[model samples]
Structure formats: structure tokens, C-alpha cells
Target: MKELQQLLKKFFGYSEFRPLQAEIIQHILQKKDALVLMPTGGGKSICYQLPAIYLPGITLVISPLIALMKDQVEGLIANGIPAASLNSMMSDSEQQQVKQLCIQGKIKLLYISPERVKAEADWFLPRLDISLIAIDEAHCVSHWGHDFRPEYTQLAILKERFSKVPVVALTATADKVTRTDIIEQLRLDNPQVFISSFDRPNLSLTVRRGLNKKEKIKSIVHFIRQHRDQSGIIYCMKRSDTEMLAEELSLFQIKATAYHAGLSPQKREQAQDDFIHDRVDVVCATVAFGMGIDKSNIRWVIHFNMPGSIENYYQEIGRAGRDGAKSDTLLFYSMSDLIVLRQFAEESGQVEINLEKLNRMQRYCETDICRRRILLSYFGEEVEKDCGNCDVCKNPPLRFDGSILVQKALSAVVRTQQQIGIEMLIHILRGAARAELTEKGYHLIKTYGAGRDLSYVEWKEYIYQMIQLGFLEIDYAHANRLKVTPLGTKVLYGKTTAQLTKYMPPEPEKKKTKASTGKKGFKAQPIRPIESESVDEVLWDALKQLRKQLADRESRPAYHIFTDDSLEDMVAQKPITLGDFNQIRGVGQIKLEKYGRVFVSLIRFVLKLPKLEG
Candidate 1:
């Protein structure tokens, strides 16, 4: 334990672990299977990483994303840990070398995709001294999860082959059902489950309903412009929509690129690289764009259209404000979006199950409470205080006692035998309709014009509120026909309280205000150029060339690993010791230990030159 603390301080420089990290680490050290349910940016990696550094044999980390694997491996190496990733990026020869290192116990950790683990053709397992297996994003194995991958089913086999070896499953999002699915599929026997709170206080959440597609696009652009030069993502429902939005953002002088599966592999790689390098400030993409994107400073995430599920919505928005810095999350919803999404669900051919899920999502969109509160509650966490950032908390709309409203609506549905749709029922209440209602002579009913005091829009809003409050529901297979649940029966009998907020549209965008730059007290440092052909410059250039060749061979953009600015900064700083490197910005203690030695060697060679520093 003392040695672990000393190593933690020496490498990562952290004094202690975040909540549950130590417990999870201890569980692994004790050789126990565990499941960790941490929120995004809750230090999920440290739980496995700390254990890997101290344990004998290589810790095999199964991850779904190659980019995430590379970033983490680079981070580990920076911290002076011998970590390597065996992904598609490596050539056959390079892969063989990595496998050899793992077998020889030179590498502390080995990161691979689950698909590679399942592929019997891979010789990674045969050669390595495998200790512990850590599954990052383990929720992908469950069908109930948002991003389910078929290959994850084979991960359970690791338990059989390496029976005594411990397996640790980690994920950022999972509810009760999904958690059960994970335990059942992986056969985790009473694993030590650690679940954390989902609230992210620094993120301000808001939902705006757009009248049409153009207005929706304008709203998204407006939000992005408000937070200019900041990192963000704009999610669209379709690939074509992503392209159109990216083009529009570019025309507005916003730095953005499009990413979707439809794009060529090279283009998608370039787009991700550009975003990570800070060359592009925004990425307009479909749902596939950010599965495991680890760039931490994203300031905002805008959903151009409503998402398919609340779980997906929360996970996507959770990507923002990851740095624990203040950020914004915006969602655009329209009544028509329900129809479009319903049609899409039908086309997927999982008509019964998918439609049921979409119906729940629709009610979530129409809910009038604090949006964040509803979302968190679905994840099995409760927030007693209303979040001040959501639409309901900011400039709250008026709430007429919905008790009477619910009774009337439910009575009308029950009186009419619940056969008609909302349009006919609403028409009966309003006492106004076109020739179709007149032909049915529905106006003769005693409930006719019962709600005539309220306008058509007001009645429609009330029905939506009722649906959200669980008084009414849609029979998905029956052409989405409206029906009252048992809860509706109780509401009609005045057995329940229905408190609903009337939806009020958002105000016009506020005028832009100029922000004051940080020119007070602190002054900007001037850059001094060194003379040409310094020995340090030669080594820096050599490293850059090596990176470029590796990036090219792997079909990845070079700057993803080290930005040009970061490289230049390293050259300028020429840190001679780990301490010196740690003191520099962007040179976190881990990074200094990983790549610092080679750069320090180059600096020492330069300082020995007669024409240079001396």
C-alpha cells in the first residue's frame, strides 16, 4: 500500500483516489470480479490503471474504440508505465513485437478490442502472462445498452479460460435492467457493484422546441455562436443532415467538420483528428460520432433533433462539461419529430419492442418538470432540489391546478369509451371542428365544448401534459391511438393530484455582449526564436518524422497524438528533468515521464554545443 501511494505520487502526482477508485482497486487486488458504474469524468480509468501498474503480468484492457485506446496508452507511457495497444493500426510485424513484449513482462498493460479477443486467429492471449482483465465500457455487452456490440458476448469466455483471473467491468451509464443484463451475460457472480450519482452540476441544460427544420438549425447555430471558439458537438438524426449542418456552420465562420459511418474511413479519421487537435471547434455528426471520444474540454453538445431514448440523450449530453468546467447542453424538439421517429422505429422492423421504447421517449420529451431531474430519475438517482438550469427552472411558466384539467380530460376519454383519437376528443371538448366532426355529429354529446373555455392550442398542450404525467398513453401497435391507463381512471375519480406546468415558448435570443480578455495583471509572454540547427531541433524533428510515419502507416492523422503547438512548446521548454516538464503547461506529470526522456536527451546534447547556450 505504501509503495502504491509512492508510485501514485511519483507518476500521476495525485495525493489520493477519487470516490470509489480505491475500493474498486482493492477489489481487483483481492482477485474479485466487480462492476463499476461511474459517471463520465469520474476517473473510471484510474481504478484499473493503478492496479495494472502494481500487479504482475499484463492487464488486458478490452475497449471498443481504437482512438480511446491510443490516447490512454499514450497517457500511460507519459506517466512512465510500459503500456501498449494491439489494434488494427499495428502492422503484423509491429503486433508480433508488442505480443513479445507482453509475454516477456516488459509491458504492464495491453489494450485490445473485444472483437480481437473473440477472434481465435489472434495469438495475443497465448503469449502473454495475463493477470487481470478490465473491460472498459462494459455495458456494450448488453442488449439493453445504448451501444450494443455483438462481439461483447464472447467476453464471458475469458472467465472460463482464465477461471481464477478476476474480471472488472466498467461503464459510464447503466440502469437497473442493463446492470442485470451485464451480470447475467458476463456471469458476474455477486460482483462488487459500485454505482455513483449522475448529477453534473456544472452543466447547464435547456430544451427548446423548434417550429420547423430551418428554425431548429438556426437555434443550434445560435447556441454555438454564443459560445464561440469553444469545443462542442452538434448531433443530427441523419448523415445528410450532419453534412448540411456542417456546411451551414462553416458558412457562418464556425470551425466544424462532419463525421458519420457513411463517410470514407480516411475522412472520418481526419475529422476526428482535426477536432482533437483544436483545428476544428465543432463536429456535426450522427449518433455514431462520439461513442468513445475522450477529448475532455467539450463546452457544449446540441441535439438538432430529439434523441431516440432518454438514456441515449443523457449519455450524449454527459459528454459535455467533462472537464468539470462550466458548459451548456441544448436539445431541440418538435411535435413532428415524434411522427418522424415513430416512422423510423417502424422501418427498423422491431415493430413491437422498438415502438414501445419510442413511446416512452416521446413522453419524456413532452414532460414539464425539470428536464435534468426526469433524466436522472430514470437512471435511478433522485434529485430533491430542482435543477436551476433547465427550462422549467428558468423563467417558470404558470401552473394552473392540473387536478381539474386531468379529471376533465380523463372523463371525456372514459365517457367516449376511449375509441377516438386525441383530435376528435379534443374537438368534442372545444365544441369546434370541421365537416368531419359535424358529419359524426359528435357535438351533440354532453361533454361537447366542456373545455371550450380553453383554445385549441391550450387543450393540445394539456393533453400532452397528461400523457407525460402518465394519465394517458399511446397504444403503439394500434396506429398510435390514444388510450387511458389505469392511472387515468384514478385521476378521473379525483384520487390523484395532477400538477402540470403550462409550456411557454422561449424568449428571443439575447444580444451579444463583448467579453473582456485577460489583460489585467497578467501579461502575455513573448516568444523568442532560437538559432537554426540547434541539436535539440534535430531530435525534435526526428521525433516528429517518426510520428508522421507511424500516423501515416496507421491511416491516422499525425496531430492526434501530439499537436504542432504542443511539439513546438516541448522544443521551446526543453525540460531537462521530470520536475521541469511537470511544471510546464500541457506537460502533465504522466506525460513528462512517458515521452520526457527522449526529449531530455536531445536537450542535453544541445546544451553541450559550443555555438549554443554556452
Candidate 2:
């Protein structure tokens, strides 16, 4: 463990390990199978990368995307680690060079796609001295996961071929079901599981509801103006939406671009490249744009429409604040978006699970409780207190004892034999005289007319709350019927009570003022950059510019040189000597010897400090 810590500082320059990284690394070093579930930016890569450096032979990393592999390899190389990636994009000669390096034991880490492993593992495994196997994005292997890929199923061959080699599987998003599936599919031999806390305190979560298209556009533009000169991503649901939003944002003098699978490969690559290089400040893209993006300086992420599942939403939001700096995430959703997403889920092959996930996501957007609490609970983690960083915590809603209301709804579902969906259930409670109610004999249920005093919209809101609070469950497989969970049964039987939020009508949209559309636009409005109070703004900007210059010279992303967190550390510390600079979070011995002097000199110049003696 002591040697591991030294290697960590020597290579990655971290003084201490994150929560489970050290334990996970130790397990891997013992040549045991492990499954790790850590949030994005929680340093999952180090669990495998650092151990690979210490292990005698090269490590095989099966990744999902070419761009992701390339980004990681570049970052590793920048840290003076010997790493290479083999993908379809590389020439035959390039692939052969990486292979030769592996044979000659020159490469410490080698990345390849699951498809590559499926195609050539038989030929590839026999020639190399393999010490470890790391599967990234391991959630893709599960059919229940948000991003299921058929190619990943072929990875079961690894355990069969390399029975003696230890395997480590890692992902940013996975519920219990997906975690189990990953183990079963990969045939890992009783792998030790490590689940890090899913909390990201540095991110502020907000959801804007009841906004129309024009209103959403205006809100987004206002947000961008406040966060100008920082990198952000606006996720749209469609390719056309991306292009239209990009064009609209550009009209406001924002540096924005569009990215989607519909565009030519070259165009998509160029757009991604420009964003990574800091030549563009925003990218209006679909879900396809961000899966492979490893940019650590993304200051914010905006969702133009609600994502279909909580897993997808969590993963997308995880892309922001990777550097552990304070970042903002805004989600704008409306009923139309939910309707469209529900239709898509209904049409998909996995109708039941997809609808279940979609319903959960809708609950996330509509919940009046702590948003972070809901997210964490969905992943099987329980928290005692509400997170004060979300919109709900900042602006709490009114709550009332609605145990009777919940009993009324649950009784209605029971009277209807749990065979009705939400709409029918609501109608029965409100005593609506529909022919189906009459034919089904639901209008005569004891709970009928019990909730008639509440309006249709009010009843709808309460029932939805009941579903979200786990007082009721939606049986999507059985015609979207409502069933009482064990918790719901407790309320139905009067064993417990329920507290529900008071139904609040949506506020009417305010009339637009001239300033909203003035020629000078939002650009002329002054807004402070979203950053910590202690960080030196001017010095931060200067360091960013310097990092960009260095990245341009090396043709790599600015973060490959130093993450925003590292730069902020430097700014706060105002290091003027080589030793002081080396204390920065990301300044390893290699980086210290490579670019420490220039950075130290710049810091001295910027802070007006004395020059170091020769």
C-alpha cells in the first residue's frame, strides 16, 4: 500500500486515494476479480491504470468508444505513462506498431474496443503477457442498462480464455440489476464489488418546468450569457433541434456548434475537436455527442428536453464538474416531452423496463422533495438529510398530511382489482361518469367520490406523487396498471401515514420586456463567472490561456496538461518555486520536470513575486 501511494504520487500526483480507489487497487493487485461502481470523475481509471504500471505485464482495457480511448491515451501519455489505443480509425501500420510494443513489453496500458477483442482475442491473447483486464463502461453489457450494446456480450470469452488473469469492471451508472448482470455476463468469479458514494456536492441541480419553446430558448440564452467564456453543453432530443438551437445561440454572438449522428463523420469530428480545443464555448448536441467526451473543464450542462431515463440523465450530468469545481446543471422539461418519450418507450422492444425507467425519470423532474435524494435512492443508497444544493432544497414546497388521500387512491386501485392505469384510477376517484367505469363497476367502489372535492388536475398530481413516493407502483407489463407496493399497502391498511405536497398551479408566463429581445442582447449584461470565491479570477483566466497555448502546441485537450481543479489549486496556492508548484494536485514528478518551470515563472510574473535564484 505504501508503494502504491508512492506510485500514485509519482505518476498521477495525488497525495491520497479517493474513497474506494486504494482498496479496489489492492484487490486487483492480489489478482482477484472486482466490479466497481463509481460516479463519473471519481477516478475509476486509476483503479486499473496505476495497478497496470506496477503489474509485471501489460493490461488490456476494453473500452466502448474510439474517441474515449484516444482521449485517455493522450492524457496518460501527457503524464509520461506509456499507453496506446488500437481502433478502426488507426492505420494498419499504427495498429501493428502498438502490437509490437505490447510484444516487446514497452506499453504498460493498451486500450481496444470490445468488438476488437471479440474479433481477435484468440490470436491476440496468446502472443502477449497479460497481467490484468479492465472493462470500462461495463454497464453496456447489461440488457437492463441505459446504453446496451450487443457487442459487449462477446466479452464473456475473456474469462474463458484468460482464466488465471484478474478482471476489473467499472462504470459511472449502474443500478443493482445492471451490476448483477455485468457479473453474470462477464462470468467474473465472485468479484468483490465496490460502490462509491454517488453524491456530487459541487454540482447545483435545477429543473425549469412549464416553459414553451420560445420561453425555453430565452431562458437558455439568458443562462449562456451569465456563463459566457466557459464551456457548456446543451443537450437536445433531436438532430434538428441541435442545429436549430446552435444557430439560435450563435445569433446571440455565442460561440456554439451542432453535433449529432446525422452529420457527416468529418463534421462531427470537427465539431468535437473544436469544442475540446476551447475554440467553441457551447455544443448543442443530442445524446450521441457526449458519451466519448472527456473534457474536464465543462462548467455546465443544460438539457433542452428531459432525458428518457434517470441513468441517462445522471450520466449526462456527471460529465459536468469533473474537476470538482462548482458547476450548474439546468433541465427544462414539459408534458409534451414526456408524452413523446413515453411513446418511444412504448414502441421499443423492452417496453416494460423502458416504461418503468421513463416513469422514474418523469418523477425525478416532478418531485418536490430533494432531487439529489431521489437520484441517490434510485441507485440503492440511502441518505438521512436532504441535499441543500438542488432547486427543491433552495425553494422548498408546502407539505400537508395526505394520508387519507393516499388511502383513497390505494383503495380505489384495490376496488378496481389493481387492473386500471393512472388515468382510470384518477377518473374513478373523481367519480367521473365514464362508460368504461360503469361497465367495469368502478364507479360504485367505496372510495369513489372520496376525492371528488379535488379537481382532476389536483387528483392527478397527488396520484403521481403517490407513485413516485413508492406508495403505489405502476405495473407496466400488465397494461400500466397500478399495484400497491408493500409500503403502499401499509398506508392502505392504516399502518402508516403519508405526507404529500400541496398542489400548486403553474404560474402564468410573464409578458416579455423589450430588453429580452433588444439588439444589444444578453451579451451587454454583466454577469460574474461561476467560480469559487477564493479563486483568483484574473489569474485563473491567465492560467487557462497558458494551458490552451500549451495544448495547441501539443495538439491535445487543455485538460491533458492540467485539469481545472489543478489550475484552481495553483491559483489559490500562488506557487512561486518548483517545489511549491510540484505540490499542485496534478503535478507529478514527470510533469514537474517537464513544464514546472514555465508554470512557476508565469505564476511569479502574474503574482508579482520574486524570481527564483538560478
Candidate 3:
């Protein structure tokens, strides 16, 4: 175990493991199967990568993204570890060379896609002395996952073929249903499962509702301009939207590009390569664009349109600030987006699940409470108080004595027999005299016309809040009926009272400024350098610049080479010797042997530290 810790410091530049990583590695080293649910950029790769180095024989990693595989392999090789990848993009000679390396016991880790694993397993399995099987993006195996792949469903063969070999499955995002499905689908044998916190404190969450196209585009442009030297992505709903938005950004001289499944393979590859190499400033793309991208320096992510689910939104927004630096995400939503997304769900053949997910996403966009709390709650994690970083916590809405309005809404539901949908109940509450309503005699009810002062949109928002607060329930499968829950009944009978935010009004256009243009209806806070009591801010920035320079020289993403957290550790410790450097959190042995002297000398020179006598 001490040797493993030393290896972590020597090779990966980390003195300790992230939460659950060391335990999972220890479990795997003990030949136990495991499942890990850490967020993206949570160091899931290290959990398996480090164990693969120490475990006898090669560990075969099953991943879905070729680009991700390439990035991992490059980083491993840069760290002086023997790693190789086999994908369709490799030439026959390249593939044969990789195979020879594996047969010669020169490669410690081999990354291959699930489809390649199935196609080549027959010939490939026997060539190497396999010790462990590590599966990345394991959520894809579950049919309920947002990124389901049929090929991933066939990965059960890994455990079936190698009955004794321990398998570890991992993913960044999975709800309870998806987690159970992945466990069953992968057929793990009593694997230890670890779920880390879903909260991303470095990511500032913001949401805007009903932004017109012009405003959204302007807002996106302002965001890009604010971070012009940095990288960002604008995610749209449609391919055409990507192209159009890319053009709009280009018109503003932002040097933007578009990427989607609609683009040709060559074009997509070019865009990805350019973005990775920092040739492109921004990418206006659809949700399909980010899953395979490994660039870690992305400064922000802006959703030009509403996504289908909170899972997708969280995963997409995770692309930003992967280095543990402060980053921002802006989501623009509208009612028409909800309608279109619902229609898409109806056409998807899995209507109930899709609609349920979509409805949750809509509620998230419309919620008046703490955004982070609601998001964490959806994934079964609970935070005690509001995350002050979000817009709601930053600028609270006007809360009124809404008990009367709540009683009216709930009472109208009962008076209408609790048999109708929200629209009908809303109509009755507003005292609508439509022909059907008149024939049904809904106007005669005492609660009829009770909410006449509120508009249709206001009533809808109120209903949404009621549902979120557990005051009401939607029988989604049964004509989408509105039913009063126990909480609603209490409110109706005066046993409970409620205070709700007033109806949302149209937001005035904000005057664009350096720090205020990233999000609509809100201003983005100035991104400050990482700070701690033990370190100087200017020195920390210098260390980051040094890390960036090293990363550029190696042609790797900055974080993949050395994370911002690692740099912060260096700045804090101010180590001037290899021994002292190894004491830093992320300073592994390989990094110390490779670039330790340069960093140590830089620190000594900058801080005027005296050299120790040999």
C-alpha cells in the first residue's frame, strides 16, 4: 500500500487519491469487482490506471470514445507508462505494432471501444495475460441511460468469457434507475459501488427563461467575447441551429466553428482537432458534440436552447472548468422549447420515461428555490442550504403570502372532480365561459374565477411550483391528470399555508460589460485566481502559466498533463527539492523524474530560497 502511494506520487503527480479512488483501487487489487459513479473530471481514470500499472499483466479498458481513448493513451505514454489504443482510425501496421507490444508484455494498459472489444475479443483475448477488465462510461450499457449504445449491451461477454477476471465499471452520470440497470446489465458479481457527490462548487449555475433568439444569440456572443482568449462551446438543439449560431458568432469575429452528427466525419474531425490544438476559439454545436472531446481548458458552456433532461444538461455543462477552476454555465429556456421537447419524446417511442425526464428538466428551469439543491436532490443527494453561487440565491425573487392563491388552485382541482388536466383546472379557476365549460357547468363552482387576476403563464408557473413543492402530483400516464397530494389537501383545508414567488415578468435587457454579458438577466462574476491562506495569488498564476507552457510543449490538454489542483498544490507547498515536491498532492514519481527539476528550480528562483548543501 505504501508502494502504491509512492507510485501515485511518482507517476501521476498526486500524493493521495481522490475520494473513493484509493478504496476502489484497493478493492480491485484484491481481485474484487467494483462499480464507480464519479462525476466527469473526478479522476475516474486514475482509479483504474494506477492499479493497472501495479497489477500483474495488462488491464484492458473498454471505452466508447475514440478521442477519449487517444487522450488517455497519450497522457499515459507522456507519464512514461506503456499504454496503447486500438481503434478503427489506426492503420493496420499501427494496430499490428500495438498487438506486438501487448504480446511482448510491453503495454500495461490497452484502450479499446466496446464494439472493437466484441469484434476482436475472439482473437485478441488470448494474446495478452489479462489481469483486470475496466469499463469506462458504463452507463451506456443501460437502456435507460441518456447515452445508450447497443454495442455496450454486449459487454456482458467480458465477465462471461473471463469468469475469474475482476471487472470494474464506471460512469459520470447515472440516476438510481440507470445505476441499477447498469449493474444488472454488466452482471457484476457483488461489486462494491461508490457514488461521489454530484455537486460542482466550481461551476456557477445560471438559468434564463423565455429569451428570444436575438437575445440568446447576443448573450452567447457576449459570453464568448468575455472569454475570447479562452475556449467555450455553445450547445444548440438542432444541427441547423449550430450552423446558424456558428455563423452569427463568426460575424462577431469570434472565430467560431460548428460540430454535429450532421457534419461529415472529416469536418467533425477537423473541428475537434482544431479545438484540441487551440486553433479554434469556440464551437457552436449540438449535444452530440461534447461526449468524445477531452479538452480540459474549456472555460464555459452555454446552452442556446433547452436540453431534454437534467442528466444531459449536467453532463454537457461538465465540459467546462474541468481543471477545477471556477467556470460558468448558462441555460436558456422557453415554453416553446418544452413543447418541442415533449413532442420529440412522443416520437421517441419511450414516451413515458422521456417525458418524465423532460418534465423534470422543465421544472428545474422554472424552480424558484436553490438550483443546486434541486439538481442534487434529483440524483438522490441532498444539500442542507441554498448554494449561494446560483442566480436564485444571488438575487432572490419576491415572495408573497400566496396561501390564498394556493387554496384557490387546490380547491379548484377538487371542485373539478380532480379528473382534469392543469389547463382545464386553470380555465375553470379563471372562470372561462367556453361552450364545453358552460355545458359542464364548471363556472358555477365557488372556486371558479378565483385566480382571475393571474395570466395563463402565471397560473402554469404556480402549478409547476406546487408540483415541485409536493403540493400536487401529475398522473402522467392517465391523461396527465392533476391530482392533489396530501400537502395540497392540507393547503386546501387551511391546515397548511404556502408562500410562493410572484409571477415572473419579462427581464429587461442588460447593458453589456466585461463581466456582465455571459448570461441573460444576470452578471457573471469575475473569475479570480485560485486562492489559499498558504499561497500567494500572483505566484499561483505563475505556476499555472508554467503548467500551461509544459502542456502546450507536450501537445496535451492542460489538465490532462497537470491539473489546476496539482498546480495549486505546488504553489502552496513551494517545494524546491524532488523530495519536497513528492510531498505535494499531485506530484507523482513519473512527473518528478520528468519535469521535477525544472519546476523545483523555478520555485527556488522565484521565491529566493537557498539551496541545500549536497
Candidate 4:
């Protein structure tokens, strides 16, 4: 255990294990199967990577994307760890070289995709002395998971092929159902399940309701301007939306690029590379763009549309604030987006499950309660108090005794035999003289026209609230009809009351300038560096510049060289000697030997201090 900690500091440069990382690593070191559920940036990699170094044999990592594998391998090698990747992007000779390195026991860790493993496992498994297997993105194996892939199911063969080897399946987001499915599908043998708290306090969550296209663009522009010189990602629903949004951002002189599967492989790779290198400030992309990204300095994430599920939203937002710094996440929600997502869910093969997940995501967007509480609750983690960081907690909305209104809606559903959806129910409540209502005799119900004082949009909002409150549910299997839950029955019978937030329509977005022009009309604004009270601004800027130079010279991401957190540590500690430099967080032995003196010299030069011997 002491050696493990030493190796952790020597290789990964961390003095302590994050949460359950140490326990998970120790269990794996004992040659046992385990299931790990930790949030992004929670040090999941270290659990398997560290054990591989001590286990005396190579650890095989099954990853989902080539870019992800590449990033991990690059970061490992930069830390002076023996790591290599085999992917379709590599040539035959390159693949052969990596295989030979593995056979000769020169490489301690080997990363390959599930598809590659499926094709080569039969001939490949027998050649290497396998110590352990690490399955990343393990949620993809479960049909109940958000991002299910058929290829992941084939991985069950690993336990069968290597009966004595330990396997660890790790993921950032998975519900109870998905976790169970993963264990079953992967055939893990009595695996120890370790679930870390699914809380990312550094990320501030906000949802903007009812924004028009122009208003959303304006909001995005304003946000980017405020967070100038910081890296961000704007996620769109479609490929076309990515391109259009990228162009819109560029019109304001923001260094933005478009990324999606529709683009050529080279173009996608270039976009990713530029973003990782800080040559691009933002990447407007579809969901496909960020799954494999490992950049640690993303200061914000913007959702251009509602995601299909909370899992997807959580995973995407997890990309930001990875360095555990303060970051922001903004999501724009509109009725049209909800409608589109519902249609997609209905069209899916798993209609009931998908719609249920989509409804939860909708509730997340519409709820006036703490967003973080809702997010944590979805992952089965109980929080007694609201997270003070979310917009709802920061600025709470007005609430009123809405028991009468709830009874009115529930009574109408009962009068109509619960045969109506949200739209139809709203129409009936608002006394709309529609032909379908007249044909269905809904206008004559006793509760009909009871909610006529409220506008159509207000009623819609309230109904959605009721759905989120568990008083009502949408049955996707039944023509998308609304059904009263047992909770709703209580409300109808006056057994319990409910509190509802007052519906406030979005204010009109003030147009400051033309869509194609900047805020000052054509002249682009200069990006201001982020400010911190504790950090010395001048030294921080210098360290970033030096890090970027080293990154470009080595052809690696700036964060790969030294994350922003490390830079801040340097600014605070102002280490002047090699010994002091080694004390900085993330400064491993190899890094201290490789780039230690240069950083020490920069610190001394920037602070105008006299040079000192070690």
C-alpha cells in the first residue's frame, strides 16, 4: 500500500487518492473483479493504471473511441509510463510494433477498442501475459444504458477467456438499472461495486427557458464574451446546427470550429487538435464531438438543445470543470426541443424506457427546485439539502398553494378517463373550441374551463410541473396519453396539498447589435484573461505561455504538459528550486527530471528572485 502511494506520486503526481480510488486500486491489486462508478475527472484511470504498474504484467484497456485511447496513451507516455494504443487509424506496421512491444513486456498498458478486441481476442489473448483488464465507458455494454453499443456486449468473453485475470469496469454515468445490466452482460464474478458521489460542485448549472433562436444566439455571444480566452463547447442536436452555430460564433470573432461525424476524418481530427492545443476557444459540435475529448481546461459547456436523457446531459456537462475549477454550464430549453426529443424517444425500439428517461430530463429542465439535487437523485445518491450552486438555488422562484389547481387538472384527467396528453389536456382546461375536444365530448366535463383564467402557455407550464412532481405521467405506449399517478389521486381527493412555482414567461431578449456585427458594431472585443483573487495575474499568464510553448514543441495538449490547476499551484507556491518544484501537484519524478529546471527558472525569472541551488 505504501508502494502504491509512492508509485502514484512518482507516476501520476498525486499525494492522495480521490475518494474511493485507493480502495478500488487495492481490490484490483488483489486480483479481483470490480465495478467502479465515478464521476468524470474523479481519477478513474488511476484505479486501473496504477495497479497495472505493480501487477507484473500488461493491463489491457478496452476503450470506446480511438481519440480517447490516443489521449490516454499520450498522457501516460508523457508521464514516463510505458503505454501504447492499437486502433484502425494506425498502419499495419504500427500495430505490429505495438504488439511486439507488448509481447516483449516493454509496454505496461495497451489500449484497444471493443471492435478490435472482438476481431483479435482469439489470437491476441494467448500471446500476452495479461495481469488485468480495464473496460472504460463500461455503460456502453448495457442495453439499458444511454449510449449502448452492440460491440460492447462481445466483451463478456474476456472473463471466459482469461479465467484467472481480474477485470474492472468503469463509467462516469450509469443508473441502478444500467449498473445491474453491466454486471450481467459483462459476466463479472461477484465484483465489488464502488460508487463515488456523483457530485461536481465546481460546475454551476443553469437552464434558460423559452429562448428564441436569435435570443439563444445572443445569450451565447454574451456568455462567450464574458468568458473570453477560456475553452468551451457548444453542443447542438444535429450536424447542420453545429456548422451554423460555429459560423455564428465566428462572426463575433470567436475562434470557434464545427465538429461532427458529417465532417471528414481529417477535418474532425484537426478541430479536436486545435481545441486541445488552445488554438480554438470553442467547438460547436454534436454529441459525437465530446465523448473522446480529455482536455482539462474547459471552463464552460452550453447545450444548444435539450438532451435525450439526464445521463447524456450529465456526461456532456462532466467535460467541463475537469480540473476541479469553477466552471459554468448553460442549457437552453424550448417546447419545440421537447417535442422533437419525444418524437425521437417514441421512434426508438425501447419506447417505454427511453420516454421515461426523456421525461426525467424534461423534469430536470422544468423543475424550479435545485438542479443538482435532481441530478444527484437520478443517480440514486441522496442529498438532504439543495446544492447552493445551481441557478434555482441561487434565485428561487415564487411558490403558491397550487393544491386547487392540481385538483382541477387531475379532476379533468379523471373526467376524460385519462385519455388525454399534455397538449390535449391543456386545450381542454383552457376551454379551446377545438373540433377534437367537441368530438370527444371533453368540453362538457365539470372541470372543463376551470383553468380558463390561465393562458395556454401557463397551463402547459403548470401541467409539466405536475408531471415532474409525480402527480401525472405520460404513457408513451398509449397514444402519449396522460395518466394520474397514485400521488395525483391523493391531490384530487384533497388528501395532500402541493406547492407550485408561479409561471413567468421569458422576457424579450434585447438586441444590442446586429446579428452579424459585434457588440460595438463591427470592432471585435479583445479577450480578457480570467481573474482570480489569490493568483498573481502576471505570473499566471507567464506560466500559461510557457506551458503552451512546451506543449507545441512536444506536439501534445497544453493540459497534458501541465494542467491549469498545476499552473495555479506554481503561481501560489512560487517554487524556485528543483526540490520545491517537485513539491508542486502533478509534478511526477519524470516531469521533475524532464521539465523541472525550465519551470523553476521561469518562476525565478518572473518573480525577479535570485537563483538558488537545490
Best lDDT goes to which candidate? Answer: 4
Query: How do the candidates rank by TM-score, highest first?
Result: 4, 2, 3, 1
Candidate 2 structure lDDT? 0.88
Q: List the candidate 3 regions with Cα displacement exceeding 4 Å.
A: 226-228, 401-549, 570-585, 600-614
Clashes of each: 4, 0, 12, 0
Please report, as a residue range, the 10-residue window in candidate 2 with the lowest summed lDDT.
519-528
Error of 1 at 512 (Å): 5.0
**Top candidate by TM-score:** 4
**What TM-score does each of the candidates earn?**
0.74, 0.81, 0.79, 0.83
Q: Kindly provide the TM-score of model 1 when superposed on the true structure, using C-alpha atoms.
A: 0.74
For candidate 4, write residues 1-614 as lDDT tens digits.
79999999999888888899889998998889999999998888999999989889799999999999999999999999999999999999999999999999999999999998878877976799999999999999999998999999999889889989999999999999999999999999999999999999999999987666897998899888777678999999989989999899999999999999999999999999999988899999999988799899999999999999999999999999888888999999876688789899888999999999998998899888899999999999989999899989887899999999999999999999989887788888888999999999999999888898998768877887887788998786687788999999999999999999888665444543222222221112222223333236656766777777788778899899998888879988999899899889899999999889888987786676887555
Candidate 2 per-residue lDDT, tens place, 27-135, comes to 9999999999999989999999999999998999999999899889998998889999999999999989899999999999999999999777768767889999999
Q: How far is candidate 1 from the true structure (C-alpha RMSD, Å)?
A: 8.6
lDDT (10s digit) by residue, model 1, range 36-81: 9988877788888888888888899999999889877876775578
